[model samples]
Target: MRVGLFIPCYINAVFPQVGIASNKLLKSLGVDVDYPEDQTCCGQPMGNAGFENEAVSLAKRFDEKFKDYDYIVGPSASCVVFVRDNYGRLRIQPNHQCVSEGKIYEICEFIHDVVKPTHLKAKFPHKVSLQNSCHGVRLLHLSSCSEQNVPYFNKMRDLLTMVEGCEVAEPERPDECCGFGGMFSIEEKAVSVQMAHDKVQRHLATGAEYITGADSSCLMSQNGIIASEKLPLKTIHIVEILAAGL
Candidate 1:
């Protein structure tokens, strides 16, 4: 399993630890991992903002960077969604080849479905509210909602159950947007904050010590509001908890 790790721009800048943990976890499971320095943003931010034309160059760059890897695993679901969904629109010939040849996997999905760790050493006593990233839930369908009549899409829950003391809770309205839709946070600050506030309120009501999700952007959005309001909730990436051991 020659896996190339794709660290999103936000994770690369702010939560590099998540990327590190992901690499360590994968290697610990006996998979060969590689991080290509030439890789940068997956052009998700620009594509989400209707700037597909502007994103072409970045997409081309990313395509060339990791085209040979068997699988490109990313820590952020949104970034994976960006490449999985929009890489075909890059218009460049090599970009198309890259998308066709390389398999993109979000870290949780890879762990739950592909790697399937036999012995998880992670133990987290905190009850966690599962904040499903919009792209992962709505776009990539990484995990299924109970509202939907699907049976095979609960990979996130399956992985969480493997952790020793971790409990997963769903919000009042499962799969609601956390409002960190890339540039939406900047362009629609008021609405973005309100949505994040609502999400945090729901998480708080669950009485969870930590809110956890596969997407850091959604966690970051909720964490900011929780911090400003001085709430007792802390946000964590799912991998961070999974990497822990009691």
Candidate 2:
């Protein structure tokens, strides 16, 4: 399948390694992946901040750029959630052609549910604390929660288990937010830090060497606290762990 890779602005700038690892992982699985250099933000920052006008402009730009692809995949759950959930709200005329022609997927969801790399050569011998990105968990319902009876969120855990020596640990509250809601950190620095601190504390309490998640933004927020406190935890994107074999 031909897929267009959309690396969000933050991932492109701060966590470029995750994008590179994602590309390598997909190609290793024999999927034809295309990187549209012109692709940009999905306008989630503005949309989450109540500036739909600004978000619409960026969303229009995104729709125009990736309109031809069969699938638009990315590493950031937040960005993917924005595109999947808000692209329809763009003020511009809906590119029905693109909407009908292309699909948006978070990399982990795509791999665990769609690609299903049954025999990965990857191995990570570390206890990993899984932090659920708010958009992915609460908004997309990517993970199974007690609130939902059917249990749908084990995709990440299942994929991780395939890696030899990798053990996934559940946090005290698996579905809590990391408080890295883009501008929410800066707008409410004190509360944001406190939330992040709590999340990191839970992970550290688990004695996990690495804290892994689908969103780098959340990891980055937690990393700040871990660094300041000199915690023995490292943060990684799920793709980075999967790409370890390569």
Candidate 3:
């Protein structure tokens, strides 16, 4: 199947390597992937900022850009969740709703649910703690969250272990929010810092050398605290780890 890679605006400007690695990882898995040059922000920022009307054109533009592809995959679960949750509310566009639905997937979700690769050639040997982004766990239903009584299953954790020598650890609170709710962090800096501080400390408690997660947005926020506190921890995007293994 043909796939279109949707890189979030911040990731494109800041963590371009995540996008590059995502492309490489998908390609190594024998999937046909393309970067739609016309793609822009998924409008998640604006929509989350209480400006749903302003994100309409972006939603429409997004639909226009990836509508023809068999699948649209992005490295971010939050942005993908935004599209799935908010894109349909903008009635200015037709029900070109696949952009808002199953046709789009977070990278790990696609890898586990669609590609279904039983084996991989990736290997990264390190003790890593998983920071499950809220959108990935709560919104996209990527795995069995700590709050849910479902059977133990983590599509992302399972996929990350394919890297030889890589050990995935769990934080004290498995599925807590990173507090980078787009505008929420800015508007609630005090609460955000406290939440992030607690999360980082718990990850550190796991004796993990690196903190990894599916969403780079969360990594970016937590890494800020990691750097400011002079901690020995480092943040890694899952795609980067996956790409390294390949």
Candidate 4:
């Protein structure tokens, strides 16, 4: 099946390698992948900033961009979830179905659920703490929420397990927010930094050399703290980790 690679604006600008790795990983799995170069933001930033009207045009543009693909996959869970949840509200088209009845999926979800590869050629010989971002855990159901008394299942961990020499661990509070709530980080700078600091400490306590997750925004938040304080930790996208040694 054909898959459209949807790279979010932040990822495209700040972390281009994640996009590259995602493409390579998908290709290595023998999946036909195409990246629409003209793609812009999924309008998540605008919608999260209390300026949703400004995001309507972007939603329309995004929907038009990848409408024909069999599946739209992206590395960021938040962006993918935003498109899935809000596209109907934007109603760019007449009686629009949001993301065409959820045609879009986070890369890990797509790989784990749809591609269902029994093996991978990737090799990352490092211990990594998995960051279950809010959108990934609560909304996308990538993993079981901690508050719920349900059987535990982690799609990110399941995918990473296929990689050789990769040790995946989780923080004590696995699904806590990293405080990069788009505009919330800026509006509540002090609170955001505090939350990030706490999150970083918890991640480090796992004795992982790197923090990896499906969402770069959370890793970006913790990376800021790790960098400023010179912590012996690094942030790498889960896509990068999975694409390693390919």
Q: Which candidate is the best by lDDT?
A: 4
Candidate ranking under lDDT, highest first, comes to: 4, 3, 2, 1
The C-alpha RMSD in Å for every predicted model, in order, reads 2.0, 1.8, 1.3, 1.0
Candidate 1, residue 18: Cα displacement in angstroms equals 1.0
- C-alpha-based local distance difference test score of model 4: 0.91
| TM-score of candidate 4 versus the correct structure, residues matched by position | 0.97
lDDT of 2 by residue, 50-162 (tens): 88888877777788788787788899888888888767756455545436123899888888777877877688888999988877776656687756677455677877888
Candidate 1 backbone collisions, by pair: 122-244
Give the true-structure RMSD of model 4: 1.0
Name model 4 segments beyond 4 Å from true: 98-101
Q: What is the per-residue lDDT of model 3 for residues 1-246, given as tens digits with 9 covering 90 to 100?
A: 999999999999999999999999999999999999978887888888888888888888898899879999999998888887777777646754445465889999999999998877777888899988888898898877876678988888889777878899989878889777778889999999888989999999999999999888899899989999999999999888888845
lDDT values for all models: 0.82, 0.84, 0.87, 0.91
By TM-score, who's the top model here?
4
In candidate 1, what are the lDDT values of residues 1-246, reduced to their tens digit? 798888888898999889888887787778899999967787777787888898888888887787778888989887887787777757657433555234888998888778888667778887998888877887667778656787645667778888888888878876889888878899999999999999999999998999988998899999999989999999998888887752
Error of 4 at 16 (Å): 0.3
Candidate 3 has its poorest 10 consecutive residues by lDDT at 92-101
Report the C-alpha lDDT of model 4 over 125-194, residue by residue, as the tens digit.
Answer: 9999999999999999999998999999999999999999999899998898989888889999999999
